[model samples]
Target chain A: AKAKDFTYSNRGMTLEEDLNETNKFYLQSEIAVIHKKPTPVQIVNVDYPKRSAAVIKEAYFKQASTTDYNGVYKGKYIDFEAKETRFKTSFPLNNFHKHQIEHIKQVLNQNGIAFVILRFSSIEEVYFLEGKHLLSLWYRMEEGGRKSITISEVQEYGHRILLGFRPRIDYIKIVDKLYNLS
Target chain B: AKAKDFTYSNRGMTLEEDLNETNKFYLQSEIAVIHKKPTPVQIVNVDYPKRSAAVIKEAYFKQASTTDYNGVYKGKYIDFEAKETRFKTSFPLNNFHKHQIEHIKQVLNQNGIAFVILRFSSIEEVYFLEGKHLLSLWYRMEEGGRKSITISEVQEYGHRILLGFRPRIDYIKIVDKLYNLS
Candidate 1:
């Protein structure tokens, strides 16, 4: 089922690059308008070069952002964070931050679509877990539950996102099913 | 009526800062999830110290972003650009790039709320103009029309945003009226 043409171009691309490429395809096709927020940086010093663009001489990477991607899909607000975990047995819940968890909860309260795209890099498979379900496990962990969620647990709770030629991840198909979107 | 408390607090803050502060207030109150996208920078060089955080040694400012702010409001995706013009007569259309205009158009096509918050910095008044109205003026300009929109025209086509204490701009009230939200 793996086509040579599809395999060749996406061979060495990182997960972030792959998602960005897919997002570009989606935008060009008028399917969606998701965009990854730029990494925040605390700029300290800058030099204004004469008759040219300003050069930043000193800066530091700022704190972690709220989420990676967000946009409108079918008149509904879509927000998600993507993560790739190496462990095949379980996914470490520590990958998400406390503030990010709060952000997802807020999105749900606003009646928007909120979820996370978790990629098992070893297995080369991705899963979509709803914010509500993730929140439940997160609270359990705070209450002294296991620090990681087993692969089987994810298999039962999350939707498997099949890879495709065009948009690659095709997460929207899962979104349609999850949100009952027309 | 310039209140002493409001003046003292917001004295040195720029229009952008005021908006950001208002956004923070909105987010904290769970009223909306709007955020100003960080200024994008192009990294050139980095210094990685063994035990400390990596420092950006060289970088340059990137191109202007699509819009200044975006997020979910009342289950509807909201996208907008904020601009403050010192001109009392009209807003120079040059303030907007071709791509920004196209972005607002895309937001409209997606059934999301798309608008611009224009501040007449001199008079300390702001107006909310719909993307559709902007497009009409943009197209007219492309066809060799006026390079700027008159204040009278804006008063007719745009909604005046009242100032407030906590949220500052209070643009959401205008949003409710514009969208006819219950």
Candidate 2:
């Protein structure tokens, strides 16, 4: 394989960039208003230099308590986490935090649309796994059954995302189909 | 008045803190799932010490492109920005950006609940101003009218939030009434 051929995951862009571009497109096209929450950081120190912007001198990344992306789409609340895994056979459960699982359950209880977007980077494939499915998987894990959902299981329970140029990955189309927006 | 009396806005805690507490209470009680988005920061440089967590060496705060607080309530998409003003007579228009205005408009168009939580700190009064009302005020400003929405106008178009111990500011009750959630 040519070295450049390896860059086929949405043309060398990670799922994050693809999602950002998708969100930007969504906003511009008035399709949706989702946004990835800012990377959480714990600022320890800052310096207010003369005639310059305040500079954070000491800081650390903090784990997000909620999903990465959230917004309203067609009168419904949308929430989801996007992850890229190199593992070919399965999507690992360790990519998620316990609180995040709880958060998804809470969102489901509130009747909000929540899900996980998993990108199998090695295969350049993406899937939209619903919040309920994730919770069921978590429960199964709690029962000491399986630590990860196999790719075949994901294929059975999740919708595959079709990538495109306009919105990069058209996840919203999958969402609309899943949630019956249309 | 004693110096300690100065700490009247939710016992010296800022509106942000108060809202955070309120959201936490709501989450715990299964009333709602709102959260203040983390302060946006543009991370520039980072250092990875062998045995320590990655340290952000340089960063700067970035103006938020959307409203701060967003979540689900009674299956509705809720989004809002909270601001406290020391101005006695009015809430200034400069507290919002153009894109935020656009965001609120788009959210409203999608049939989501959108509003601004305003605190007139001098009097310790907080009002939930509807997104449509805010858009009207912004339009008025664009038409060479008032640059700020007077307190009277806020009182007319907004619902006053009662401060409470458990939630700090019971804004959800106002939302329930305003949007007929209950």
Candidate 3:
């Protein structure tokens, strides 16, 4: 079983990388315009060597308040955070931060489409859960509810994103269905 | 004249800082969700100190391929790049790159609002020039046209953004005009 796990791990690309590749394909095909926000870094010090490029001598990673990816889809604003977990039974609520939950609410208030791409990597499956659905679970957790959502609950609430060759994950196809786009 | 120039320079702020402050105000008011993309940096090395935070020891800033700020407003996608120039008579065409023009075209094709925020720093004036208008000039430049657009031309083709106290530059009001939203 461990050897089989190793094989799966070796063959499987990270969900982020897959999404990046998918976005690139979408961009080239003129379907959508999406991009992953760069990791915020705090630069403290820099060294300018004579006749050479300046080097960042000291820096630290800064916490981002928003989601990882966002862009335009069929003239609508789309925003989301991508997360992957190995646990097969359920997805732990701790994976999401407090600020992110609030951000999703704000996006919804502005009438924007916001969601999370949840990947059960061990099972090689992914699901797209809308912001409203995530908020319900988030509020439940806040009120001493279940620590995690069961796999069946995810299946019931989230739309499955089937893997593909070029896009790697065809989540937009599901978006079209959700938005009633032809 | 020199004294007057000093007075203008002393009172005027950089367009970018002004825009950041404006965006912050917009966010606080729940008007729109837009943010300038972080300057991409190529992290070369990092030092993880024991019992302390990791520090980036070496890194270099990377050139950005796309426009600066993007987000959603009124359920529609919005994207734009901002540039300020000291030149009073004309905005140099070289201020925009080839890829950025192409990117703007792509955004427009997808039915998203795309534009350039042109700031004449010396005059303390700003204008919003839409992507289609920008393309016209870009194509003209390609055909060995004038290297820049005169201030008169900008005033004729773009919407002037007046300075304000709350949001600093009221570009959104101009956007309202462009989208025919009161």
Interface RMSD of each: 0.9, 0.6, 0.9
Q: Candidate 1: misplaced stretches above 4 Å? A: A1-10, B1-10
CAPRI class assigned to model 3: medium
For model 1, residues A11-96, the per-residue Cα lDDT tens digits are 76567877888888878888887888888899999999899989899999987557888888887898899988999989999999
Q: Show model 3 residue runs off by greater than 4 Å.
A: A1-10, B1-12
Compared with the true structure, all predictions reach lDDT values of 0.84, 0.90, 0.85
The TM-score measured for candidate 1 stands at 0.95
Candidate 3: DockQ? 0.73
- Pairs with steric clashes in candidate 1: none
Residues B74-160 of candidate 1 have per-residue lDDT tens digits of 888988999888898899999998989998888888888989999888777788998899999999999999989889878999998
| Order of models, best lDDT first | 2, 3, 1
Q: Alpha carbon lDDT of residue B41, candidate 2?
A: 99
Candidate 2 vs candidate 3: the TM-score winner is 2
C-alpha TM-scores of all predictions:
0.95, 0.95, 0.93
Number of backbone-clashing residue pairs for each candidate, in the order shown: 0, 0, 0
